[model samples]
Target: MANDKTSHEIGIDGAILATQVPGNNGTLILSIQQTSALNNWLLKWANYLQNEQTPRNEWLMTTILIKSKSLKIEHKIAGVSPQKIPDSQYQAQGQRVTWVLMAADIQTT
Candidate 1:
């Protein structure tokens, strides 16, 4: 896909650094306001990854599809799961802090 001809033609492979995981351990950074429902769900999600003893592979495994012609970072991310979610912290300016979730076994197509 790197057949250079014109600009803005870079494929998905070109965005990635290499076969290894990108810096920051492929963490998906997210944050939710205190009033948002996702704030609760995010806490539960992190708890599940930390406390759940038996991980149901069939149910927990997920696939994420993203589409964006603007930046050309669209791809189907499969086998997504909560790899690591440490303590939740908030900034002085905002009530909700950014949570980093590490996901592995990602494949783009």
Candidate 2:
């Protein structure tokens, strides 16, 4: 799913809520978290809100807990961390992180 929202809205509220829904097989809190994280990171890192890539289809969501406190900056600046959930178990594809979701695995929380 593609989302065009701020990181705070998606990450703090959206992701947290998504982490509480049940799926066809069972509850998929983990998937929700991962997806939320992916979306959140993209918003912050890729800066998709301003100038976005057209036909943005190829993207990935990774399950990443905050590695210590995250510092939200334009790019990589020194000694800056924001309030984030640390110690994430992010699953990565290549050098980037993404959350792979199954068809039946939908988040309700």
Candidate 3:
């Protein structure tokens, strides 16, 4: 998704700037802005999702809803990881982080 007025108006703002669904396997790549508040939440959320002790299969079936304009896209959670932004791409406004969320299955609606 592009960082346009439409995208921002639809809820994709500073926190989550963009999203991409690669192929038909339901892999989602989220472009997010890093902040102290988000850092705390991301660590806990990512830890829980990445934990081996958690039931992976059940978690994989979880659905995430993304809304933009009049469109609503649903994605299933297969896995997730929080990655740091390279220094070269860092911006003064805030650090950039990529959150990769994989899906167990892809859905079309």
Candidate 4:
């Protein structure tokens, strides 16, 4: 997905913005700005994750890679305040609602 497009154009880029590996477990962090479109997308994505048995059902897991492999990650809708960026930081970007989601990956060697 092109970075230049406004958040409205793309619901969420299935990108792992950051990652951390500790022992056999991995953590993936993704950020999405809160736009009307993004809010709708998040709800659908979260529902799928919660209801689907196959982790592969999640588009983000299929599209995002960690350590050159598709990760079976578990996620939760983290509270908004901790993940929220200060208005001062996002005002210029026109992003009022922002969320940081963390996905946990259990890796088997």
Candidate 5:
């Protein structure tokens, strides 16, 4: 179907649960299924921000996209700083973690 597109075409990065971008503040909390690949990806950005040396923490910026059959959303987070990650524990199936991060700028589209 040339004119038909499903949520499957959005190319989700991983098994996402939910996303929260609270108000005008540059804060984003993302909840997703816990996996080694996803853990590494999140930690990579957090570590980069931690190691970066710059004033106002403006050295880093990243974009997050959310898609579904009825809605399409995007958020641009800048100067992101790692906030929290779950501790190591033996969790059963469908265990999810909310990754907290703060940024200098949070743009929406």
Candidate 6:
């Protein structure tokens, strides 16, 4: 279903993970690599939910990877959905790593 593009769909460039380490001097540590288009898509979806006032149940979660084995991974994006992302789905491409982020339900309370 991801192959099909809609009018609201945003083209993805890449995504990365930023994690905080206890003794890292409060620095934001980033993973090495991320798949292109993932972050962009999530952001687009998030914005759509906000703009359209859609319910959280209408949103779908996803995790995507680059198709090529030879491609280089750059950086990670933070705060993607956990339900869509799993640890097993990632492979560290040498010095490159990946991050997880969330595009979750919008709540007002």
Give me the candidate number with maximum lDDT: 5
Shift of residue 30 alpha carbon in model 6, Å = 8.9
In candidate 4, the residue pairs with backbone N, CA or C atoms under 3 Å apart (3 or more residues apart, or in different chains) clash, namely 34-97
Query: Cα lDDT of all candidates, in order?
Result: 0.54, 0.33, 0.51, 0.40, 0.58, 0.37
lDDT of 5 at 69: 40
Please report, as a residue range, the 10-residue window in candidate 1 with the lowest summed lDDT: 16-25
User: Each candidate: RMSD to true structure?
Assistant: 9.5, 18.7, 14.0, 17.5, 15.2, 19.8
Indicate whether candidate 1 or candidate 5 has the larger TM-score. Answer: 5
Q: Which stretches of candidate 3 lie over 4 Å from their true place?
A: 1-24, 36-39, 57-61, 71-93
Error of 3 at 37 (Å): 4.3
lDDT of 5 by residue, 28-76 (tens): 7777767757876987666665664644434445555444546666665
- Give the lDDT of residue 80 in candidate 6: 34
Give me the displacement of residue 42 in model 4, in angstroms. Answer: 3.5
Candidate 1: where are CA atoms >4 Å away? 1-25, 56-60, 69-72, 83-94
Candidate 6 is scored at a TM of: 0.23
Per-residue lDDT of 37 in model 4: 77
lDDT of 2 by residue, 8-106 (tens): 325644563223333222111222343465656744644442236633432323222223345532211222222223234546632332332222222
Q: Which portions of model 5 show Cα errors greater than 4 Å?
A: 1-23, 51-59, 63-73, 92-94
Pick by TM-score: 1 or 4, better one: 1
Q: What would the TM-score be for candidate 1 when compared with the true structure? A: 0.49
User: RMSD to the native, candidate 2?
Assistant: 18.7
lDDT of 3 by residue, 1-94 (tens): 2122233224545465454434444456765666666555765766676679977754444466554546665433333233332222456676
lDDT value, residue 87 of candidate 2:
33
What is the full ranking by TM-score, best candidate first? 5, 1, 3, 4, 6, 2
Tens digits of lDDT, candidate 1, 1-109:
1122233444677863324323212445667665468767776766775565856664346556777878777665555566454355566654765565544434444
Candidate 4 error regions (>4 Å): 1-22, 36-39, 52-63, 66-109
Tens-digit lDDT track of model 4 for 17-97: 443323322333444455557665765566565655736535345233334246655333212112232232335454544
